[model samples]
Target chain A: MAESSRADNRVLLLKLGVIACVMFAFAWALIPLYRVICEVTGINQLVKADAPAPAVAASDLAVTAAPVRLRFDATVQAGLPWQVRPLVGQMAAPRGEFVRVDYEITNASNREVTGQAVPRYLPAAAGNYVKKLECFCFRQQVFKPGETRRFPVVFVIDRAMPADIGEITLAYSVFDVPGQGAS
Target chain B: MAISTTAGHAPHEHGKPTGLWRWLAATNHKDIGSMYLWFSFTMFLSGGVMALCIRAELFQPGLQFFQPELFNQLTTLHGLVMVFGAIMPAFTGLANWLLPLMIGAPDMAFARMNNWSFWLLPPAALLLLISFFVPGGAAAAGWTLYAPLATQMGMGMDLTIFAIHILGVSSIMGSINIIVTILNLRAPGMTMMKMPMFAWASLITAYLIIAVMPVLAGVVTMVLTDRHFGTHFFNAAGGGDPVMYQHIFWFFGHPEVYIMALPAFGIVSHIIPTFSRKPLFGYTSMVYATSSIAVLSFMVWAHHMFTTGMPATAQLFFMYATMLIAVPTGVKVFNWIGTMWQGAMSFETPMLFAVGFVCLFTVGGLSGVTLSVAAVDIQLQDTYYVVAHFHYVLVAGALFSLFAAIYYWFPKMTGKMYSEPLGKFHFWWSMIWFNVTFFPMHFLGLAGMPRRIPDYALQFTDFNRIASIGAFCFGLGQLIFLYNMLRSIRHGQAAPHKPWEGAETLEWQIPTPAPYHSFVEAPHVEAGDNGVIHSMTGGAHH
Candidate 1:
């Protein structure tokens, strides 16, 4: 009886050990699982990469309705030794019609520097409605010593945007990317 | 039989080692249980000191004694110490001492491994304590160690991570030991269904620990690698979402709540019935309630993350799932009251605590249900309401149950009875002051007072002062418990075997102070024989 009990103990221990190992692996498994869920559900919008906009027919554009006022803003993060300013302060563009805005960047530092631009939308909900066709924020940019460059941002505000939001501000802040060169 | 060979070297037969070696190389369950209890009590005091420091700073509005950073460290350490150091180990100690004796087993299935499991704790605790002196101070990011904040902490965070790893390993080993002993070492006729409620609770709790402690280890490892090894598991710049960390942590954490409570449920189940002089009401339902709670615990992890911007559908699903827990929990509560109904009941110190646990834990449970609403949680999250909610469940629920167990088993453990008046005094003192300290936090939380801050606005002054004063008194009350326990161990009245008339279990069937070896020959139990009923009605022993 004792011998059988001892054998039973060994089998139970092995089973429990396997459970612990499997749970540990499950924790690691959650990472990819979480990403897949977020993408499939279109939740966790901040983490999801911006998808390329599908082709829009002319009839889909709301060209005759009232235009929404758009405000452009740009700033360089501290210690980056870079300056950025919107070439156009603001514009009014009809809903569903694409609008283009320009911003100029200058590197004041002596060495070539790599930086990434992150964009923020005012009233954060606007992020879901404003679709970007092309933007400098999509990738890291490299500026040579004393270099100046111009970048264009093209976007269309969906007609489904709430009417209460008459104006939207699109802001960009550039942060230095350490330990990386232009790829 | 292998049992006789192992029993030949029983400490009682060969005369056991004395002094430090007795504890250091101890394989006996009772001695290891005693060590675990003492270690947890020390940790309880350490965590209590941190709590008092926090209350002191929050006594008024401004930062008087501690910097915000230091205050953050105190709150963080207090939480980690209480949950991991004080509460979890206390339950493990209770299991170590009680499970084998209750189930008529010779000793734990893996006794040597039990020693290693316990000894690992001191080093891990030492690591946590010393982290405070490190260059950046301890991990200032709260006990949750939510990332971005956690990733920015200094060397102390790494120490905390390593300590948690060691602690996790200890818990897993201890849990494995428990599962094996309960499953494999029952005597000839003590079937799983016939075992005491405490044994069933411990069995389920061990499985819960086995399932979740590894996940905790895994998440903390990711944090360590993120800080030093260029991994971006939580770094948004590297395509890792911080919310994902919340998801994984709560997956382990929600069940962790029951890991603390289930053992308390077991302890209270014994105390209430023993005092009431009645068989436990709805014994079968009690087991089902415990098992259901464990299973549902895994599904409600997302409730803690309602404010983390989960979609409304996910939020609603988690909210409803969280609320669904209250049903089985309510069933257990109902059954406890049902046991005490229309019985010849006594108000022993243990019973007082058991009753207190029932009442206050209900309040905590109700508040938990209130917080389960995703919309309401948006307001209550990070408030003193959350703090108040858990303290009720933990302090009133788990800690109260621990006190009751100590009192209920005092004579059995020490071979002497504690001073009754002093025991009652300790109970009332802790009971009143505990409410004074935590109950007002509910109001403060409702008034929009955020938690974990060094200072509050002027309007939040009066209640904070009351809570602080109550906290100091609450801290003082524990000393009485300490004194009673120590004095009783040495000078209290000598107890006979079966000190409590209504007490009925295999442990009570043994000698006082319980011998170093018991049940060398497995005791045979018969079908349809509840241990309590048979023993009380003059049934055969062995």
Candidate 2:
């Protein structure tokens, strides 16, 4: 009986050891799985590289579309010596139609600079519907000393967007990437 | 295995080893348990000091005492020390001292491993405390250690991670030792369901520790690699989502909440029945309820991240699952009240803390239900309401139960009776001050004061002052406990083998000042046996 109890303890120890390992792997598995879940469901507004939102068939347009006012805003983060502003402060677009906006950027410092633009949407609830097809935010933009460039963002306001949100403001803040500086 | 003749004796049975060296090299569960308790008390004092500092700063709201950065460190360390250092270890200490006695086992299954597990804690604790004096101060990103902030932190964050890693290793080792001991070493006839509730609680908690401690280790290792090895596990530019980090974290983090509470539930299960002079009401249902709570804990992690903007369906699912937890928890609460129904109830210090635990913890549970609603949480997230809610659960639930267990077991442990008046005084003082300190924070949260901020607007002044004063009184009240315990060990009345008349556990059946090698004979118990040694000795030993 003593020997049997010792063996029983050995088995339980091994069992606990295996459970610990499997749970560790389970925690790791949730990482990639969460990204997939977020993208497929559009929960957390996990932006996809090509298009963030599900494709809304062109046929689903509103029969009599109301015009929505779109506004653009841009600014440079504290340490990045760059000047960036929206080319046009506001524009009008009908629901279910695509809109294009530009932001002007200039390197205000003596050295060349590389900056990444991070996008933000007001009412933050509107983030998932403001799908970007092409935006400067998807890639880093580089500027030479005394250089100026115009960056464009192409987006479509889903007809499915809540009617309460008649006005949408898209803002971008530019920051210098440390290791990618001047490249 | 026949019951041995040596089962019910005092320390006079053998020559006792003496000196600090005996403690330094000891493998006895009783010695190690004493060490764990003392160490946890020291940590409790340290963490309590930090809490007072926080209340002092927030007294009038404009960072009266500390710089904002220092307040951040104080808040972070307070949470870390109290949760990890004080509460978790205190229960582990209880398990060590009582499990072998309660289950009629000779000692833990792996004695040397128990020693190693406990020895690992001091160094880890030193690493955490030492980080404060390091160049940039200890981790200021809060105890959650969310990435991006963690990656950007200075050297102190690295120390905190290392400390956490070491602490995780210690807990996992302790957990394995516990699992092996309980599953393999219960005395004959003490079947799985027949084991005491404290043992059952430890069994479940140990399994939980093994399952989640590694997840913590994994996440912290990633954060370390992300900081030093350029790994992009949480870096957005490098194609990693920080939200994924929160997902993995809360998976482990949510269970950790139960890891601290379940053992307290087990402790209270024992206390309520004893003081009320009745068998625990609905024992089978209580076990099932604890198991169900453990299972549901895994599904409710996302309720914490509701404001992170999960899909409405996912939010709804988590909200419902979180509310489902209230059923099992409500069952346990009712079981406690039922245990006291129509019985000769006594208001001993331990019983007072036990009853207080039920009342305050139920309040916390109700607030938990309120916060579980995705809409309500959207407003309450990261607010003082969240702060108030957890302290109700943790301080009132876990800490109160811990005090109950201490008062219940004090005579058995030290072989002397504590001053009953002092114990009651300590209980009332703590209860009043505890409520005063935390209750108004709910209003403060509803009025829009965010947590983890050192400075607040002028509107939050009056209640903050009241809370600060209550906190100081609460801190002072604990000194009464410390003095009472110290005096009891040296000068109090001698305790009998069974101090409380209604107590019927295996621990009470043994002699007072439970010897080093408890239950070396493995006393044989039977089904429906109240106490084998109690009946055998005919209650004359005491």
Candidate 3:
């Protein structure tokens, strides 16, 4: 009888704990979930896709000048096994204008390096670009020892390139070169 | 003087089991439940390993060094194995184990069929595993096996189809058994209303399985026929609509989601009151809520397909229907809170996990509500947001509940107390690291990062990088849990007759190191009608 009393009391306490916590979690999540629902249903469009800014200076889509002499300061990655050199330089272009940049590479590993140079476009947080021509991404690139090669990329910034989009950053890593099964 | 031992007063009935043998061999209700619990736990760990593999590969991205195809396989296998292998089986395992245990029955209504049902699982798992070696690779199309792409895969597709068939057969058999058991096996005094919450949940889940496992089976069979027999169920060129497959699939697939989660609801209901010191707050409502969710599940199938060029009104209907689920589900959540109100709460390891399960599972649930809205789902649907959302539910929601169940019941299973410190450590690490891992994916996903892509545009890097680190931590945290399970099973502190300081259940009535044939002569159960133990007198319940 004594043990049974303890069991009864304990069950009541546990039942209360579960009920309280479950309700709290449910209520706590309701706000965010409702926001999500609003976002999905567009009933309350509280969250909007961040809009890109339009160009201030480069209103024109066409480049006024031909490809001028261009060069970029280059450095190899620290302790990096591969040889990499930037082959493109900074340039000014009108809004909605297209540009190209290149990187040269040589395989430093004993094995052949073959993979695409995956490009990451960090477009000033407000601009967008479409890559029309590319070498070595989602495809493959192969470099043997002392094999010097240039990887070229062609891109166009939309007229919506935000006025603040002065620095267009492109970061590339040669990857999926089918290395050891370390991953 | 040599005194002969009296038959009625042997020292704890040495060498006499409490009918646990039936759980091992006989196709009975009690035996099946035990088998399901054990099987699900084992698969839970195995699927955990697969999750770890995904984390390891994505730990750095840039092919930090892994096969791309194999990476795809890991993500695919993680989903397949967890769905078909871990969560599905675990629930079924619970159904097999508990539905009978709680329902006041000697065995499942169909005993031999019950044995046959469980036997299907191992072969299916083996076939799924064997696909990894199938010449080119495993089924790269994913568990969904969306056609054209699925049909394009090589011989391994055959193995995947076979595995699905076996899994379907297993599910169907389990469901049939449940339906029969629930309909036929109630004791004289037990009415359906008087049945345990787990039984109620089981009844609904079984109905779902019967309805949809066949649809899934039928779909896979068509895939087989398409591949070998020239049937064109999903072939557009052959006048079949690929979208029709999606329709049929999500039709089965939507309810299938409830099929996995509703049992979890049942489990939490069982566990909370045992530890919280309260009666289950809304027993009848919980039963109603479960049934409502199941019925609503069928209507909400199209919600998953709104972004697939569905008509506007259809999408609206789906959105409204999907959002309505929150009502009963809210009731359940309210019920759980009611069960825990003002209770003298203690945090035994099981209770800790139960608390964690409630919090984390809610996060997943709310996210589910988020996607149920059609517009937000359009952006969030295919992205890492969806990935983050579902994983939160499955891992934090379903899997964590399973952990709590283990902590609560491990004593009865093995007569040992897992290290409390270790279990707590495991719980905190997983809870912390899991959030660290999955929370950021929401932002990345909202920022428009699509899932299943090997690489992403550079702007999404910071969140992905943070997510990757969290993934690694989450993966590592699981080791603590795995270690606890192994260590406790082999060498933990010896358990007393009742392990939890304040647990009350039929299972706890047995002695420590529960005899094998427990309940051969069933204890005259006298708990209140709704699984709350009010008191009964028996020693060791032999």
Candidate 4:
């Protein structure tokens, strides 16, 4: 019985040894298989994500041949507590070139109260080019019993825009401009 | 092993379960075991029907047949049915049948809890199924039930949450029973090490369910409060961060993954050596690895949320923790193949599935590492890649292990052998069609197709069509398996003692039609060279 038991132990040990070797091979094989799978599955697809380009920007063609000629789509509201960002929607540019924003603001308040409306461009980077558009930050508006106001400014750009870049963005804020008492 | 009954319970013979009352009032382990199995099989088919509905819907795009609301409902129901209905119940069923037999015990320590545990599921599933007809339709928020979205859903979501709570309670009760039984009910000769791999696995998995099922319960509870009771636990407007919800969910969720997988680990451990006709290799190492994987499971919860924009330090910690799981998991795979190496081998259907499990589970594991990388996961987090990875783990790993287990033990249960040729055909069909259905999903996901979308860009139309076809074939093939199991049980040729030609387990060595009671005289213990009972023999089983 002892001899038979000793032989069984030997067999068990040998089996264990062989088993270890097989495991090593399986693990090794998995490394490359994993690599191939990762590559196939686009494991690196979102590493450096690029934001999508906009569909079509009218500002894209605000070229060096013209001033920053921007057309604003305006809606006038009577007694609705708001007015358009650009009334005449007049934007000055060097004919066909890209520069900065130019626009007119109208306050439709009945009382001698002061407030300001912020402007935003369709493409984001248009705000990056400055000095052409007069901002609400410049001065306080006081409508002395129905004030019809027009604000304007002038500036240009360094003329550096990507050819495929067909969009520019401008964003602004609207608030009761400082030093003008509306409350 | 070396445990006293933490709770007071008598070892009672308990009368034989007879008539309908027996089933209703049944606390005996055997009756409960049979009930769990039958219930799971019923659920398996029911879930299978939902899968077919999903396949039929996706058979053609452009809303050919089913409307989008119905399509979303089908998908939601499919997820709930498969997760709660089919897979979890299947594992619990195996636990019921095998726990007593493997442990050399008369029955589970708390048999009443086992019965109560199973009874909860039918009612809960009924509620979930019944939600379909109740006014606003089923929960289409998907299984994760991401908040604000889930909060805003209709009555179906409410029913689904209630159903989830019931399922959670059942799982916890069932787990507590297994833990108590494994600890207290082993025969006198058995030690902890003498326990089968399955017992150790179920022990760990039981602990997982007990710990995390409560967390899932807590999570859904919070969801309910957020939705109806004006709680701001997940509302960002009320000083609550939405991302915190993901943290809690995955905390429960990651361990829930292990709760499913560790049993598969145990099943694979059991089947690998049987077919190889060899003693299990690295038995102690296997134990340690299982424990390690369980421990690692808690820390890796955040790996799922890598794309949710956590701090760099937090992301790094989670990423590394997740990767370390691969080491222990790797050890398990090594141990399995190691058990089979240079041994005499035969290709029974059980063995075939076991071998397939090794290869395919590795495919699942290797993909797991890709998701573990903080940088790489940014792209893959909620895509079809995540979907495919889990199915590979759950389906190929757990479900295939389930198949191998069914094939392995059908004889012991039925007293007859299933046709081997037919079994092999089912295996190959499942294997081929499973790959076809899940593999293309990776490419589609990589090609930027997001998951949970009802419609997709025209570019993805072809792969979806092919996948739909694969899904149908796969669902249809399961019929072959069900038919084979039933036919074999009723009228197939008789199975002898130890039907697997070279299987060495005590379960196989027992008589065909394994009697209502087994080894009732005295325990027969087998000792290895190290004077350890490799597995305890259940002599006092009756």
Candidate 5:
């Protein structure tokens, strides 16, 4: 009887061990699983897709509508040795109308460096409504020693945006990407 | 072979080792259980000290003693130590002591592994306590250890991660032993359904630990690799999303909450029925409710991350799912009340703590439901309200239940009855001061005082001062508990074989102080011998 119970113990241990392994593997699996869930749910849509935006019809633009205030903000993370400033600090653009804003970037470091810019919306809910048509944040930028450049961001605020949100701040933080050149 | 032969002998036939070596190399379930309990109490005191320090600094909100850096460390280590070191090990110690005796097994299935599992805890706790002196003063990213902030922390973070890994391994091993022992070693005719609620609760809790501890290990391992091994799993600068780390961490974290809770529920189930002189109401439904809670715990992880700006549809899904947990939980609460309904209920120290658990855990549960709404959570997130919500659940709910278990089983384990007056005083002292400390925080949170801040505005000063005073009182009350337990073990009156007349279980059927080998031969369990069901038949047979 003791021998039989020992065998039963062995079987139970093996099964529990397998379950633990499966759970460990499941944690790793959640990475891909999270992406799929986010895609399906339309949450975490910070980055734009690779496909180019469809051309907007001239008639779709609402030029005469009341304008919403737009504030531009830019920052450079530490270790990047770069400065970024929005040429236009703030502006008023009518909803459903395309607007372009310029930003100046200077690499103060002596060596060539690659950097990527990530954008954040102030009233986070506004991220889905602000569609990017043309933005430098889509790809990494490489700069030679002490180089400077100008970039423009073109976007249209969807008319479906809530009326109470009359102002939106678009901010970007540029971080140095080590061991990579511009793509 | 010789050691095995000797260990198998009946208690009085052989000489057990004496002095420090006995504990250092102890293999008996009762010895290890005592060690686990002592270790957890020590950790509980340490964590409690850190909590008092935090309260002291927050008394008037001007950085009185600890700097913001050190305050953050106190908060982080306080959480880590209390959860992993104090509560979890306390439950494991209880399991080690009670499972074999309750189920009529001679020993745990793997005795040596039990010893190793317990010993691993001290080193892990030591690593955490020693971290305060390290550079950057421990991982200050809160207990959740959110990344980017965590990535930039100093050597203390690495030590914290290593400690977490060791704790994870220890938990997983302890869980495996529990599952194996309960599944394979129950006395004859003590079928699964016939088994006690505490055993069932431990079984489910063991499954939860095995399933989630590995996920925690995996997520923290990723954090470790990101710190030194150049992985971009959580670093947003390298094409990775930081929010994903939140997803993975809460995936393990939500179930971890139940891992601490389910055992408390089990412990309460035993005490309520025993003191009320009744069968546990709806034994089958109670089992189903526990299982439902465990399964639902996984679906509700996202409720913690609602402020991370999930889409409205996703928010609604999580919100509704989190609220659904209240249904099974309500079933449990109702069952506990139903057991006490119209019965000869007595308010012993254990019963008082059990009744206290039901009342306050509901308060905590109701607050949890209030925070489940994504719309409401967005406003209340990271506020003192959230702090009040969990402490209501954890300190009042989990810690209260532990006190009940210790008092209820004190006689059985020590062969001496603790002072009833002293135990009752400890309960009331803790209960009142506990509310004084945490209840005001709800108002503080609603008024917009953010948590984890070393300093707050002048308007928040009154409540913070009240909370600080309450915290010191609550800390002092535990001293009475410590004294009660020690004095009873050394000098209290000898207890009868069954001290509580209402108690019915295999453990009580045995001699007092419980023999070194509880059952040299497995006790046969007849169908009507089931305590829960037998009580339902109304006690006439006795």
Candidate 6:
């Protein structure tokens, strides 16, 4: 009886050990699995930047609509040592027409530095409707000491955006990249 | 061979090791258990000191006592130490001391592993506390260790990670030892259905630990790689969403809360019936309810992240699943009240704490239900309300039950009786002050005070001051408990085998202070008419 009970104990312990291993694997798998769930269900509005932009609705773009106010904001993280601001603070553009804005950035420090800009849409849900064609945020920007450059963003406010959101604000915050040198 | 031969002549006389070396190399369950209990108390005091420092800083608001960084460190370490070092180890210690005695077994199945599991805790605790003295101080990303922030922290984060890994290893080993011992070592005819509620709760808790500790190990590894290696698991610039980190974390984190609570449920379950002079009202339902709570725990991890912007459908599903937990939990509460109704009840220190747990834990649970509504949770997620809800659950639920266990089993473990007047004073003082400290935080949270900030707006000053005063009184009340326990151990009157007359468990049937080897000859158990196990030979003493 003792022998059999010991055997039962060994088998049960091994089973539990196996379950622990499987659960660990499942935890790791949850990463890609969450992406798939998001894709299938459209749960998180995590618009994949790489996906081919849905063929712009030619009919929607042609509609003559009222001009909407588009505003630009720029801020640099404290440690970046850069002076950055939108060259044009605001613009009025007809809905569905493409528009472009420029932000001027200068490396204020003595040494050349590299920085990246993170973009945010004011109402957050407006992220999916705003498409970026060319933006400084796509890659790192290098600036020589005291050198100034014009960074541009080209986008269209999809007529698909709700009419109630009459105005949209696009903001950028820049952070320093530690390892990469100035290009 | 020589020791076995001498045991034949004098069966009760076994070779006993003495002094410091004995403790260092001990494999005996009782000695290791005593070490675990003492170690847990020491950590509890350390964590309590950190809690008081946090209260002092918030006493008048405006960062009067500490810089924000130091305050964050105090709050972070206070949480980590209380959960990992104090509460979890206390439950493990109680299991080690009582499980074998309750089951009529000689000792734990893996005695050496038990010692290793216990010894692992002190070094891990040292790594956490010692980080406070390091260059950048400790990890201040809150105990949640949300990513991107955790990735940017200094060396203190690595120390915390290693500390967590070591703590996880200790819990896993301790849990496995519990699972094996309970499954294999119960005396014959005791059967799976017949084991005590504490052992059953320990068994389920062991399974939960095995399931989730590895997940904790996995998530921390991801954080490590993100810091050192070129990985962007949490960095959005590198194509990783920070919310993914919350997903993996709450998977382990939610069940971890129940891992702290289920054992408290088991402890309170025994205390209520024992003091009420009645057989437990629904022993089978209690076991089933505990198992249900564990099963439901896994389904509700996402409730913590409702405000993190999950899809509406995901939020609704998680909200409903979290609300369903109140059902099984309600059943357990009703059963406790049923046990006390019409039974000649006595109010001892343990009974008082047990009653306190039932009432306070219900308050915590109801607030939990309110928070489960995703709409309401959006407002309360990171507020002082969240802080108030968990303290009610943890300090009142887990900590209150721990005090009750100590009072209930103190005589049996130490062969001494504590001062009843001091014990009652300790219980009442802690209960009143505990409510005073946390109750105001609910109002503070609803009035728009966010947690984790060292300073608050001038409008929030009054309640913060009230909370700080209550916290000091609550901290000092524990010192009285410390005095009572120490005074009892050294100078109080000797205890009888069964100090509580209404007790019916196997532990009460044994000799006082329990023998070096409990049940050298396994006791025979048959189910009595009450559906409670009574040993034929063991009950002869009655």
Per model, kept true contacts as a fraction are: 0.67, 0.48, 0.00, 0.00, 0.58, 0.46
Error of 2 at B253 (Å): 1.6
lDDT of 2 by residue, A107-127 (tens): 988887888888878877678
DockQ (C-alpha) of model 1? 0.39
In order of appearance, the predictions have TM-scores of 0.87, 0.84, 0.70, 0.74, 0.86, 0.87
For candidate 3, what is the TM-score?
A: 0.70
- Report the number of backbone clashes for model 6: 0
Residues A1-183, model 4: lDDT tens digits: 324433543454344334434433443343345447647865434344346544435665454334344555433211224354644444444432334334444455555555544455665455544445445446545555545555554444424433433443333334343345554
Q: Candidate 2's chain A scores what TM-score?
A: 0.65
lDDT of 2 by residue, B1-542 (tens): 21122234442454445898667765677888888888899999999999999998888867568888778888988998998899999999999998888877777776777888888888988988888899889888888888778777778899999989888988888898888888878776777776778888898999889988889888988888888775778876456678777888888899999999999999999898888998888888888998998989889999989977577889999999999999999999999999999979999999999999999999999999999999999999999999999999999999999999999999998899999999999999999999999999999999999999988999999888888899999999999999999999999899998988778878887888886666766666663322223332221221
When sorted by DockQ, best at the front, the candidate numbers are 1, 5, 6, 2, 4, 3
Task: Identify the candidate with maximal DockQ.
Answer: 1
Q: Which lDDT values do the candidates have, in the order given? A: 0.87, 0.84, 0.69, 0.71, 0.86, 0.85
- Mind giving the per-residue lDDT tens digits that candidate 6 earns over A1-183? 545655676676677778878877887888999889888888776444455445656665545366778889887754578998988999898776789988889998888899889898888767777888999999999888888998778988777665667677888878777777545
Docking class of 6: acceptable
Which is the winner by DockQ between candidate 5 and candidate 6?
Answer: 5
Per-chain TM-score of chain A in candidate 6 equals 0.65
lDDT of 1 by residue, B450-474 (tens): 9989988999999999999999999
* 3 against 5, candidate with superior DockQ: 5
DockQ of each: 0.39, 0.28, 0.02, 0.03, 0.35, 0.31
Per-residue lDDT of model 3, residues B388-459, tens digit only: 888887888888877787777778777898889988898888888888889988888889988876667778
RMSD of each: 4.8, 5.9, 15.2, 12.4, 5.2, 4.9
- What docking grade applies to model 1? acceptable
Regions of candidate 5 where Cα sits further than 4 Å from its true position: A41-183, B1-15, B527-542
Q: Positional deviation of B459 in candidate 5, in angstroms? A: 2.4
Q: Candidate 4 i-RMS (Å)? A: 18.8
